[model samples]
Target: MERAISASDANQRFSELLREVAEGESFTVMSRGRAVARVLPVDRAREQRSIQHLLKFVAALPVRHAGNWSRDELYE
Candidate 1:
């Protein structure tokens, strides 16, 4: 659940908010009853998961052995 906090209050307790965010807590900053911003932890695990998925995708691609053609032959 996202906690609602006023902009001014959020500014006053930014440090405490950061601590909560680090612990997986999310907050929505409101301005005049409208949500203006969100404070959440960086999704480091999601990034790692994406990289792992990409590695698996690459590994599944067909492998090709090195060809004997000279590098300059194609340009000649």
Candidate 2:
């Protein structure tokens, strides 16, 4: 379950909140008593894998000579 914290409480207890999130706990920051933002641990492995996949996709594309064509030409 996500922990909820009021805006004022979050501001006052920022450090503690961060500690909880760093430990893989999720939080919902409330503004005007309504949930507005979320804090959670970074999924570094997943993020890195996604970045690597994107880079591979980009690298695999054929390089165009100067003034060759627009991106649409490559996909179409």
lDDT of 2 at 46: 97
Best model number under TM-score: 2
lDDT comparing candidate 2 with the true structure: 0.91
What shift in Å separates residue 16 of candidate 2 from its native position after superposition?
Answer: 1.3
Report how far residue 45 has shifted in candidate 2, in Å: 2.4
Assess candidate 1 and give its TM-score to the true structure. Answer: 0.60
Clashing pairs counted in every model: 0, 0
Q: Compose the digit string of candidate 1's lDDT tens values, residues 1-76.
A: 7899999999999999999999999999999999999998889999999999999999999999777788798679
Best candidate according to lDDT: 1
